[model samples]
Every structure is written in C-alpha cells, then in structure tokens.
Target: MQRIISFLCISIFLISCNKEKTDGFLINGNLDNVKNNSLVQLFRAEGRQTVIIDSTRINEKTFTLKGKIENPDMYFLTIEGIKGSLPLIVENETIDLTVYTDSIFASNIKGGKENNYFNDYQEFIKKIRTRSNHLTEEFKLAQQKQDTSKISSLRKEYEVMMEENDANDLNFMTKNNDAVLSGLILERALSTNKLEFTKIKEIYANFDEVVKNTRAGKVIAEYITANANTAIGSVAPNFSGPNPEGKTIALNDIKGKITIIDFWAAWCGPCRKENPNVVKVYEKYHSKGLEIIGVSLDGTPQQKDAKQAWKDAIEKDKLTWHHVSNLQYFNDPIAKQFNINSIPATYLIDAEGKIIAKNLRGAALENKIAELLN
Candidate 1:
C-alpha cells in the first residue's frame, strides 16, 4: 500500500510539472515582395539573443514558430528579407504580421494610443540616431586633432544634446506613456541619471494617471513602482545581523569610508562566480579608502549542511571583507529595502554616504573606481 501511494505521488508531481509548460505561437503573414526567403527572429522582451527560442527562415508568406516561453510578455518578431528589414511585436497566441509587399510595413502595428506611441517612437529613434551620429563625428574630430580642449568642449556639447533628448523623451511620455517605448525610455533615464529620481517618480505617476487601461500601462506602473521603491540613491536602509564571527553589526556604523555594499548568497552560482572579480577590485583599491560590506542572503541551517557555505566560500575565496547576514535569506530587511530581486547586487556609496552607482561589476566597476580614485 505504501509503495502504491509513493507511485501515485510521483505521477501527480509529473502531471503538475507538465501542466506548467506554456505554448508559443506561429506568425502567419502576407507581404507583397517578401519572396518566401525572409527570416524571422524571436527575441524575448527581456533576455539575450543567445537564449532565443528560435530564429528561422520563412518557408512561405506564412512562418510557423514553435517554443514555450516561461512567461507571457512582449516578444519582438523581426522579418529580415533580401530587400529590407521589418520588425514588430508579438504579444498573444494569434498575432497577425501582414505587411505590404511594395514597401516593408513602415510602421504596421495595432491598438489605440499604444499604436500612436509606436509611431512617435519611430520618430524618436531617428532623432536619437542622428544625434548619436553627430556626437560620434565630433568625438572623432577631437581625437584626430589631439585637442584636449576640443574633446572637453565636444563632450559637454554631447551631454547637453543627451539632456535635450531626455527632455524630449519625457515630453513624449506625457501624452503617450501607454507604450512599451516610453517605459523603456523611463527605465533608461532612471538607470543612467543620478539627479533625475524626482522626475522619474513624476513620469511614473503621470503614466499611472494617464494610461490606466492598456497592458503597457500596467507593466509600466509595476516596473516604475518597483524601481522607485528600492533604488541605490535613496538612503541605504539599515539591518542588524550577525557575521560569520558571531558578532552583530549594524549598517549605520559603517559611515565614514566609501562602501561597496554587496548582497549575495551561497546557493547563487552567479554570485560565487562573480566574487573573484570583486575580490581583485577590492584588493587593488581597499587601501586607497575603499571598503566592502557583504550581506549574505543564505537561508537557515540546512539539511545538506550548506548553512556554513558562506563561511567556507569566504575562506576558500580569501575574501577578507566584512560580511554579515540575518540568515533569513531574501526576507532580510536590507534585501527587501534595497529591492534586491536578484543576487550579486552591488552599490557604490561615496564617503558622503550617498549611493553613487549600482550594478557596477567586473570591468565597469574597475574602470569607475580608477576614474574616481586615480
């Protein structure tokens, strides 16, 4: 009877696992000049190309793509034909990608204000490309002339152009914040600028107020809220936790030196892999007023004896930095306050106790420190 019960349990678990799998879609389209040779690429909304489910040739006017996305979100469907290239978003089980043959779908899309946002977004893209090209030319000229003054002046001019571009983008979102482009721009703005948190919150609120009915609106609201709720520039929230040494430490006590606050865990493979790079940077810069404070997110004492994994890793990796943890895993107050949705998260706070950078890792972290310290 016990053997039969175990078999039944296993069967139920397998059935549940199979039910979790989601089906992808096929894009059926008709284009005038697209000679059955067009290529279609499926890119997840927030993933890399290497992880693409599929990129295949269109056998005919109709192309059938097959895969299961773990989540149902936006995916870019691009058609690369001999003559030209066209791209569109596929957001459902049945997506129609019909485009005119004579000229590639200049901007074929669907929906209401969201569609209008895409139209304006094409224009915005052109403007950004042009401005970026101009900046590139100016940089080239400055380099060719080996003129430091010209380089500085041109850089300043480029910065002004970028700022103007940001203002234009904000204005665009005021009316068309329901589109994915606006949300993307908003994310970029917040990610890049140190002084724009207030404006970022205002833009987020404006989107929330204006576009309340669309899918893009819902996603934008969620993203903006999450980003605003836990950001590096905001005061680093406090935590009281014991380190591997069994001594309790509070975040507020580490106030005078520049701190690189890192949140990681033993179970996270990426976090372990990234530690060596971090260790190198720490060794190189620790003496010149650089300090590291690690907050482990490992869970309670484990059955597999992984509870001491953090300590073992520190000893093996020769990590001499200050480390502490509440052993509550991600439920720790610091992780919640910092919005640490992912592991290996890092923040660079200046001696003034204000966070200056976040997610700076590997070469980028080293370059930033060299620029600031040297």
Candidate 2:
C-alpha cells in the first residue's frame, strides 16, 4: 500500500511538470553571420511607448527566450546597430526562428501559427513594395527625359498595382479575420488611409472576439468611431492650441472663411514636399477669403528640439499662415479629436464649419479652392 501511494505521487508530479512546460512559451533562434558580441533586444509596444522586455547576447550565433503570455501579442526583435527591427507574434507555444543578419525580414519564423500568417503577409508586402519602387524609378526617369507617353503608361501601371495590392490586403484580412494578425494588419491599413470607414467597420466586426479585444483592435474601433464625426458633410470637430508665437487659437476663430485644417508634421517628408503647393495656394487665396490653419504634429514637451524643428520648417517653407500644435507627436489632443492617423491629412471646412472635402492635394486642392471661392 505504501509503494502504490508513492508511485501515484511521483506520477502526479511528472504530469504537473509536463503541463508547465507545454503552457509556457519558448523562442529558440539561430542567427546567421551575426557579430560575435552583438546584442539582440526584445521589445513590446504598449500604447505609444516601446518597453524593453529582455536582451540576449549572441553566443555561437544562437539564442533562446522563454516566457508565458496569456494570449498572442506582437513583439519586436532588434539587433544592436540594425536599422529596422523584425516584428513577430508571440503566443503560448514554442517557436523556432532562423534569421540572417543581412536580411532580417526574409528570415524564417516557424512554429507559431500566427507568426506563419504574419510572415506570409510580410512577404507579400515586400513583393509589392519592390514592384512599386521599380515603377517609381521608371516614372522619374521618364519625367526627366520628357517622355510623356512612357510616364502616362507607367502611371497607369502604378495605379493598377496599387489597386491590386489593396485588393489582396482586403482579401487577406477577410480570410484571416479570426487571427490576431488580422487586427495588426487592419490597424496599419487604417493608419495609411487604405481602408474606408465602412470597410473598416465591416472588417472590425468580423474579427474574432479575442482579436477585437486586443490593443490594436481597440485602436481600430476607436479610429473608426472618431472618423465618423469628421466625415464629409459632418460638422468639423472643434479644437484649439497655441500658435507659434504662443497665442491660443481656436478653430471657431477661423470660422466665416473657407478654412483648410492642415495636419502635418516637421518630420514628415511628404508634408515638407507638399508645403510649397500649400504656400502657393495660401498666397493666391488668402485675400479671397481662404484661410489655412496648419496644425503641426510635432514635438512633445519632452522633445524640445521638435519645437525648433517646427519653427524652422515653417520659416523655410514660407508657410505664412496660422499655425498651432500641442507639440505632442501623434498624441496631440486635437489630432486625437479629429482621428488623425497619418500626416499630410487635411479637412476643408466651409464658412458654416461643415467639412466640405478631405485630403484634397496638389492640383485637386487648388481646383477645389478656386471652385469654392470663385
């Protein structure tokens, strides 16, 4: 009777140990051609901040990480001195990865099912980006050579490629609605203005409850809800901030004129490039009752340099107009009120404060201003 009781106790202990092993997550990675003393850092993004979780030194070009997570979440693996970090989904299971120092994106991530889906999507995006870059180069060369026909053809091809990419992205989201990766993909699509509000809502609704409960999923839902208030035909959301000279300005103060609420940032290359056209338009129409409020998405109080950068950009671009910002990059209250996910976004409000149009750029912007004012 004593021997039988001892055997039962040992069996239970062994079973408990086995359960713990299966419940915890492990990441065993082998890196090819990594530097002898390179350090790989693991980070998890929470809200707007990235928190470092752990760091490991490369030994024999291999490393291991172990932890337990309640559910799948995105984590980043970055090597010291690398330009970009590799993103992967970590779940409560063992995962094996093989990375080459030269090209981390092409690295193989095996074991985690979510990571597999995420990797496939990343590969697809890489292919599309390569093609887009090639076409952009060709278009620039054609423009320089004054080859209008070739330029037009390339432009058409570029548009087709973009449409196809969008279609594929939508298809992937729809097919993988239950996967956490779908939420991540949708969040990115929302930020890039690739998904309309209706489609965003639809895709979000189809997401699994677990996916919808994730941090990224909550952000997507919130963005869709906030954007509904700023849609065309809706009254423009009211906001205010300090101008460059430290005077408070309100959106209502700019009422009774055709106002362009320009969302931009000092660090945004596209915004800087688009500034000349905006300056031209402001110069042409400021006297014609057209007003622009440049809401800069620059600098937090923590980043004093962003304030100087904002001032420098305004001076260099000759943006002689009302400008304001809370100086909180992407966390500005006004930007949140208006659901601004990307820079270089604009809302054209009429005299009545109704949003008349959105994202009107270059010739489209000039044409819209002319039509409204003239």
Q: Please name the candidate that would achieve the greatest TM-score relative to the true structure.
A: 2
lDDT of 2 by residue, 1-374 (tens): 13222212211100001112456667677987877678888788764678887778878888876777666667778887555677767666777778877877566765445755665666666666667668868988998999999988987887787677678778988998877877876876775576777889999999999898887788887787778889899999888999988999999997647999999988899999999999999899999999999999997445569888999999989998899998888888898878887889999999989999999999999999999999
Clashes of 2: 1
C-alpha RMSD of each candidate structure in angstroms? 14.4, 12.1
**What C-alpha lDDT values do all the predictions have?**
0.62, 0.78
Q: List where candidate 1 sits over 4 angstroms from the true fold.
A: 1-39, 45-57, 61-74, 78-89, 92-112, 209-374
Per-residue CA lDDT of candidate 1, range 1-374, in tens? 13222212211100001112235544455554566767776665331123465677766566666664432334444578544344443333444455665655342443333444555555655565566677778788889989899899877876676666556767877766555455555644443453355776677776654344344455445545655644667655556678898998876776435778889888778988999999999898888878888998887445154458878877887888888887677666677667566788998877766677898889999898777766
Predicted structure 1: lDDT: 0.62
